[model samples]
Target: MSEPIRVVVTGAAGQIAYSLLYIIANGEVFGKDQKLVLTLLDIPPMMGVLEGVVMELHDCAFPLLTEVIPTADPAVAFKDVSAAFLVGAMPRREGMERKDLLSANVKIFKVQGEALNNHAKKDVKVLVVGNPANTNALICSHFAPSIPKENFTAMTRLDQNRARAQIAQRLGTDISNVKNLIIWGNHSATQYPDAANGTANGKPVTDLVEASYLQSDFVTTVQKRGAAVIAARKMSSAMSAAKAAADHIRDWWHGTESGRFVSMGVVSDGSYGIPKDIVFSFPVEIKNKQWKIVQGLKLDSFARSKLDITTKELLEEKEEAMAVCNGN
Candidate 1:
């Protein structure tokens, strides 16, 4: 067998971690043939829960899982890791302002970024799954100057997958028939789910779904699906979020099959007029271990307006974070 690939996951005591570790242990994310050594990181107070998770991992007796290490220190957790998933963060509590939430998460990501830069392997790819993921990813990328900005991405695949599944169900077709869906801008409520460029079995999605529904209801449904899930389950989203993380890393490290571009919140390079240095989701195609923004697709006026709104919101949050860091 080849040497084990080291993966570090932050927030190891959280619900998503519970859902994610099982898949990783079974080698579903990386592949069945590859062996894995997982380093699970959590806060000191959460170490007990992480320990419980470790015990469960052992119980599974997965052949592909070589070892599981749980720790409270980012340095220890990220040491020599091939990939780091930044899933831990200060969630937005009730009565908290957006600025306050961003400030708290910024501190958490900053330390993780420095640790990853100092201790992780040279090729570490980071996926930020925490709330306000795009801003948090930007903070981490800024702190880890040594790591390429493109290597730090926030999860938007969940939204993309949700859009595809919804479209598939509406059309009474399998998900395989859905293609070219794009989740643009931030991963939050302001995200634009573009079916304008999407297709179902080579036919434009807009052709199947009514234009009125597409213009109003479909976009709202995709953007607010998380809230709906929470309302129904009376719990936070865990399983689907974990699956999205896996899908994202798998496609990135492996490759997106022909004719598909995954949506990811990567640091913007002023593509599509988005401001530079902000982590914004775009329709991206991955090849040869790098992601390039999918260009030349004309956005209708409505899509353009929606993208602007989301990008502006992200920029404002980033500015507030910078002001706080500067003690303004």
Candidate 2:
């Protein structure tokens, strides 16, 4: 067997990590043949909770899971890891403003970024699953100067999965039939769930679904699905979020199929008129653990307007996050 792959998950005691850890341990993200050393990180007060999580991991007796290291230290958690899920961040309180939430998360990500730069392996793949994730990813990448920008990404996969599911539901087809659906810009309400170029089982999705529904309900529904879940369950989404995170890392670690693309929030290189350096969601193809943004998809006026709104929102978010990160 090859050397064990070191994987780290922050917020290990949280519900999302509860679901995510088992998935990783069972070799759902990485291959079943590959051995893994799992590091579970949380706050000092949550160390007790993390211990329980570690116990559960051991109880699972996964053949691929070689070791479990639970700690509160980012330095310890990040050390020489090949893959990292940055799932920990301050949650938005009932009365907190968006700026306040961004400020809190920026502080957390900045420290993690420094830890990644100092302790993690040079080739570590970092996924920021925390809220304000796109901007948080940008902040994390900012402080991790030694790590390549391409190594860091934010989770827009959940948004992509939601969009695809809605498309499948509308067409009365299996979710597997939805292809090339992408979430553009931020992972927030302003995101564009572009189905214009998508297909359902090789048939054009737009041709199957009414444009009126796509223009109204379909777009709005996916954008606000998280809120709806919270409203219905009295808590935020956990299972679906964890599953999407798993699919994301799995696809990235392996590769996407030919002519198939998925949404990932990556640092922009000015593709499709999006401003450079912002972590924006774009349709991308993955191979060799690298993502290339899909290009030349014609965006009509409506799509362009939707993209601009989300782009503007992300720019505003970046401004706020950077100010807090710089201690302004």
Candidate 3:
């Protein structure tokens, strides 16, 4: 059997991590036969709560899970880790300004990033899932100077999955049939759920559904689905967020289908004219442990207009996050 690799999860006592840890231990994110040790992190005061969560993981008796280590020290939790999930962040309270929220989380991510850079292997894949994730990832990457920028990602797979589900339901087809639905730009509502290249069972979505719905309703629905869930459930999305995080990591590790793209927020190389140095979600696929942007998709004028809006917002977010990180 291959030696076990260590995987780190922040916010170990939080709702999303509660849903995600079981999936990881069950070999959903990492495959069966690969052994794993879960390194979990939370605040010192939350250690008691984290101990109970660890007990539940042990109760499952997953053969592949060799150990569960919970710690409040960032250095101890991140040491020698292969992959890390930055899931904990300051949630926006009622009446909190966007700048204030960004500033608060920037402080948290900076410390985590430094710890990872100092302790984890240089090749660790870092996925940032907290709100304003793209910018949070950018700030984290900035602090983790030893790790390559390309290894840092923000979760936009949730948006991609939501778009695919909406398309599949509208067409009354299985979700498996939808491929490569583009989520251009930030993960927020400004994201463009472009069905321009996606297909339903090898048929172009345009051929299956009305262009009006794809252009207007489909885009808006995928963008606002998060808020709609909160309204209906009285809580922000937990299960779906956890599921998407699983899909994001699984696809990134296992590879996507041939001739298909998925949305991931990776560092910009000026693709699609998005500004360089900011982490922006683009259509991409992973191969040989690396993710490269999908190239050569032509955008119509309407698509370009929406991309402009989101990219502008991301650039603004980048400015705010960087300022906080630099203590400007």
Candidate 4:
């Protein structure tokens, strides 16, 4: 067996990590053969809660899990870890302004980024799951000067999975049959769920669904599904988000099959005319743990308009995040 690799999850006592930790420890990700040391990090106040989580992890007796560490220190949690799920952040309280929320998260990510840079393995892969995730990822990448920009990414797979499920439901087919669905730009409501090139069992989704529905209802549904979930459940999504995070890291670690396009929030290299340096969701193919944006898909005028809207929103977010960084 290979040496045990360390993995860390910030906000480990939270609802999403509650589900995600089991998925990782059960060897659903990193393969059944791989050994792992799981590190769980939460704020000081949550340390007692984290100890309970650690106790539960021990109760599971996962063969692949070699050890578990629960802590409130970023240095200890990040030390030599190969991968990190940055799930902790300041939640937007009621009546909080957008700028204030961004500012608060910027501070959190900046400190964590420095911790990652100083303590984590050089090849560490970091996923920012916190809100305003795209910009948080950007700020994290900025502080981690030693790590490659590609190593830092935000979670947008939840949005992609939601879009795929909606399309599959509409067409009355298995969700597994949906392929090549792209989520463009920000992970927020401004995201563009592009179904033009998507397929269900080798049939174009556009051909199977009405154009009017795809243009109006399908787009709006995917964009607003998070809000809809909160209205119904009175809590933000947890299980699905955790599942998406697992799917994302699994595909990224194991590599995607030929012709599969998974959506990820990666650093934009001006792909499809998106501004450089912002984290944007693009349909990408992965191999050897590296992601390359899917190219040459023709975009209609309507798609272009949607893309522009999201791009504008991301640029605004970047400005607000940067202002906080500069002030501090």
Model 4 C-alpha RMSD to native: 0.7
lDDT of each residue in 1-328, candidate 1, tens digit only: 7789999999999999889888777887778888999999999999988889999999999999999999998889999998888889998877999999988987898899899889988778899999899989988887888888889999999999999998999999999999989988998999999989899988999889998887788889999999999899987789999999998888888878777898999988888888898999998888877888999888888989999899889989899877766662
- Candidate 2, which ten residues in sequence have the lowest lDDT sum? 319-328
**lDDT scores in order:** 0.89, 0.93, 0.91, 0.93
lDDT of 2 at 142: 94
User: Which prediction has more favorable TM-score, 1 or 4?
Assistant: 4
Model 4: CA > 4 A from native: none
Worst 10 residues of 3 by lDDT: 319-328
Q: How many clashing pairs does model 4 include?
A: 0
For every candidate structure, what is the RMSD over all alpha carbons to the true structure, in angstroms?
1.2, 0.9, 0.9, 0.7
Q: Write the per-residue lDDT of candidate 3 for residues 194-243, one digit (tens) a residue.
A: 99898999999888989899899999999999999999999999899999
Q: Model 4 over residues 91-186: C-alpha lDDT tens digits?
A: 888999989999999889998999999999999989989888899999999899999999999999999999999998988889999998999999
How many residue pairs clash (N, CA or C atoms closer than 3 angstroms) in each of the candidate models, in the order given?
0, 0, 0, 0
TM-score for each predicted model, relative to the true structure = 0.97, 0.99, 0.98, 0.99
Off by over 4 Å in 2: none
Q: Estimate the TM-score for candidate 2.
A: 0.99
Q: What tens-digit string does per-residue lDDT give for candidate 2 at 1-328?
A: 6789899999999999999998999989999888999998899999888888989999999999999999989999999999999999999899999999998898899889999999999999999999989999999999999999998999999999999999888778999889999899998999999899999989988899998988889899999999999999999999999999998899999999999999999999999999999999999999999989999998999999999999999999999988897883
